[model samples]
Target: MRAGWWSLVATLLTLPLAARGASAQTSGYLDVDGAWVAPWEGAPNHGRALSIAPAIRRDWQRYSLSSEGAATLADPSHYYVQNLVTATRRSREWRRINFESGLLAGGLAYRGEGFRTIGAEKVPIARELFQLQARGRADVALDKWGFSLTATGGENFGGAVRQPWGVEAGMTRELGRVLLYATARADRFREYDTVLVHDVATLDSYALSATGGRAEEYRTVQPLLTMTGGGTVAMGRAELTTEFGVQQGRRMIDPARPRARKAWTELIASLAATYRIAPRILLRIGGGLYPTDYVRQLPQGKFVSVGLRLERGRRQQVDWYLPPDLPAFRIDTLPGGARAVRLRAPRALKVDISADFTDWTPVPMRRLKGGDWEAVLPIAPGTYRVSVRVDGSEWSAPPGLVGVLDEFNGEVGLVVIR
Candidate 1:
């Protein structure tokens, strides 16, 4: 089973790289990292390994297709492989609001100590896990504040998480270089057999105990709340970002001992610095300690990694950058794979934006509390000509962007999305 899964994942992963040069609208990237991972839920041995991830993406007017894969090897006998494909479609933007839906299909295979067992002899075995999910989302974004809600349903085969469903809603506020967000999520599902996660371990602890044991199937309703604050600083050719957040949730894992319901709280903190070493190359280093992922059954893993990300394309990246607090046209990736094109218009009474991808229709920007204007578009990876007007000004490009000429003999800014 493991061999078959590896073969399938390899084939699926290679398709994207093979189609790299097939179209200008398609691009791919590769990330290689080396890290030291600590224990979780009372793991005995620590792990040090290298992980490689590669993905390719193709974009159209309102639809996007992407395939991504990752391989991690702690030892010759211990390894994991994951590959997935997703296709998303966006409805036409109307009045600063857009709806998107997508379907995802993927599978993963792994082998480790006590991963699986069979028969009374309790022989260790390997298993393959498959997933299929359908999700829909609605986003309403303005100049300064944005809100999003998503509903998802999925089934997992060959895993404890069987048929599952959930809803997540989030709100974001823009504060210059800092972005603050809060999310509330509720999930109702049944786990055939779940790992007991009550006894947690410190990420820096070396001496750990074994408390992991199997439990019977139980129906659970878990509601989680998370709050995050992040800030970014630009330093020459390098950008540093710091994020801190907290998660609080209650898990009803044991129905027999209902009163023993364990409530958990965890901290989420991470710092990453990316330096543009070359036009198509970036050097990144980051580290963080995170708790278990209840949905995926991933243990509490902590690591520090240094990696290089390579962007495969012929276009030379523009070297100019605008300050986060300045009035600039920019694209910001929100949670849940949604992207918003934002413009800072501090004193404008009104703002309008047009792009070739939008069929050249001027969409009015939604104003935020502190003079930020934004609009969501279903644009894919490629070069686009964009023009914006603020407060009834002339049609011109946003500040600090590479200027170009449109076919109408008008000035516009060339924006490259990768």
Candidate 2:
């Protein structure tokens, strides 16, 4: 099962890299960390954990594909989990509002002491789980203030955890050199199998949810509500942020003891700092003192974590990149009122074209003997934006055309045909 999960990830990883030529761009990052969890639930509870997560993404003018995987190893019971996920996102921009949506599918495999079974038999209750998720986000930025909203829903296949849904809204404002923001989120999990959770521990529940567990029938209905306000100070190559907030939530309650049904509330405070050690490297350190009930089914505790991230390709070129030597495309009117579009990649192994006229579908362009790529389309009298893909990379506006930011927060070349 583990091999199959990894094989699926390998396939997803290969799809973006399959395109040949320097124009097919892919970027990603790798993160690894080791941390210790101090026990607050009970005695003999100190444990250490090590985790590695890597993600890669490829894009074409208007569409993008991404895959991520993580492996975690923990001490105390020698527990470990393997997870992989792949997703596609489509985004478009219209005037002041930008919209984006995506679908994600993934699975998780868990193994550890006492995980194989119950008592003398192997139960396999939480051995394997699968999940699917859908999410959407929208953002609007004005001169000084920006607002955004995000929503997500997902389901868990195994009976251990429930389906879950969440929504978040936020607003930010530029205040001189510091940025101030306020945000709120409400996340709720469906009722889950108390029996299985009890056997595996709430830690499993939390970790499983991270792997895509959804809400369902009940042993517990964990719902979280949080409101926070914070300010970020960015200076030179470093940024620091601090936030104070309060959270209210419900935890796993004993149905047999229905009398214990009061809601729990706690104050939340967190501080974080990030430094750019180099153009492609980042160092992050952060900590928070929020009660565990906000997320996991554990006791209230404070924790700190440090991390490093290294990136390349599009991931590292968010700010700038060298433009191609020639215009990405040239439009000429044909004899029968058709438009002849010629792409200017002198050395691309593959090239595809996408535009609103084609409903944003990708169509392969024919390669000419001179190495130029060409496609003919019956374009109507209208304004549209066209993007091209070199190899299987993210979409980008063809060179020489005017550029505009799309709803997905990407800049694509703009075209107006009359």
Candidate 3:
């Protein structure tokens, strides 16, 4: 499904300008990505292929728009198009409410031969002769630890028909460096099967199908638990997460047979870990296993899989400017002395400076003296590259404070307070 792709696009598009170094006055970004996959159990031994996708994003405060498409080349080729738009609002403490929708379409072909459809069956030669799908989601977050809910729906418009709708709710809690989350969801799917045939003389072909009608509604309830923790592990900077879940469902078969009604229970477990091998490189590994059994039948399903990924990127710095000096002050503590720095501003200036010291990975900022802000970073006491952005403007510091040139729109100074 394109749910993962759409969700990623929406996250990047709606990220706060303050976090992305964009001014509240304007927002946008360009993203490029590629991937390759090897054969799995159900897939045949076809040479690896490559795929590339590009995305564009634009945001207006709480509203955002984004779109992306990908093309792939292989013995059997495929391509996909997708787009999404979202609007979100965040509370003072950063709780979020979001609404999003998008569309996905694609075609696939195999070894010069084209099959009826992609994702329907395995053929020496297959193609997405026809397919289009639409999906949407709505979700809300409560503080960092609380309850959240999401509703999702989708439809497939193609040679073979498929439509699904579902809703899920989850709760989360944070305990020190570890977090726990649980979720439950229920959904139903309506699917159609198509077939084509050829005969001699006057050859003719048509589609045949079966369906789970309204009376054939299939329902399932899944409850999942995930635990995540991050710290400096033996493999350097690393994080480990584990998830376990259970699903129970009832399946009704058409043409009612002796075993027309089947009830099954499934259990799933997964683990993921990422290690930063170097300043700019990271390695990730993940694996999952599933076991299932029918209540009144024999064991029917079991699956195990693993994957790895390596990534490298360079970090860059940018600048932002702040509004006029709004009643802010700075306090500097030298190895043996301390001094207070003050700036003059109008009486209407309502902003204040803050400082804080914590071991949090994403350190928090604290308000300090007038016009002054400070943070005690959990890093070794050495000169480290630092960048600062003010009031949602581009970053402004070091060599050039190249933002708005108002009296209050620049860096105060970089202090080394032992």
1-418, model 3: which lDDT tens digit per residue?
A: 3433554345444534323423332333332322333332334432344443434444434444444433345443433333334333322333365655555443322222223221223333222322344445555555446565556555544322345555677776555335567777665555343333332233232223233222222233222222222222222145677777766665433222213445655666667666544433345555555432221111222223232332111122211112343323233444444333332221111222222222212332443433234443333343222334333223333223222322433232343434
Total backbone collisions for each predicted model: 3, 22, 21
- Per-residue lDDT of model 1, residues 1-418, tens digit only: 4532664466445644534432224556788889877644335656787988877766655787777888887887667787777889999988888999999888777665432211112223355687889999999988678899999899878755567788888887766444566676666656553334332342121111235443333455555556666766655457787877777777643344433456788887888988867645789999887765555555555678899987653222211233455546688777765669887654355678888878989998898765467898777788888888654434667665887655655568988887
lDDT: which candidate is best?
1
Superior candidate under lDDT, 1 versus 2:
1
lDDT of 3: 0.38
Per residue, candidate 2 scores C-alpha lDDT tens digits across 1-418 of: 4632673466445644533334345677667666554433333544667766767776655566777766666764444444445455546678888887888776666554332211123333235666678989899989678999999888867635557788999999876547889999999886543222323333233222223344233455667898989998865457799999888876444433323445778877889887777655778888776654322222454557688876545432111111234344687789999998887554355678888887889988898764468899989888888888765546777876887767765666778887
**Which segments of candidate 2 are over 4 A away from where they belong?**
1-25, 76-88, 109-128, 194-222, 257-260, 266-268, 290-301, 316-401, 404-418
- Measured by TM-score, how close is model 3 to the native structure? 0.45
Candidate 2 steric clashes: 22
User: Would you list the C-alpha lDDT of every candidate in the order shown?
Assistant: 0.66, 0.64, 0.38
| Model 1 alpha-carbon drift over 4 Å, by segment | 1-24, 41-44, 113-127, 175-181, 194-227, 252-260, 314-418
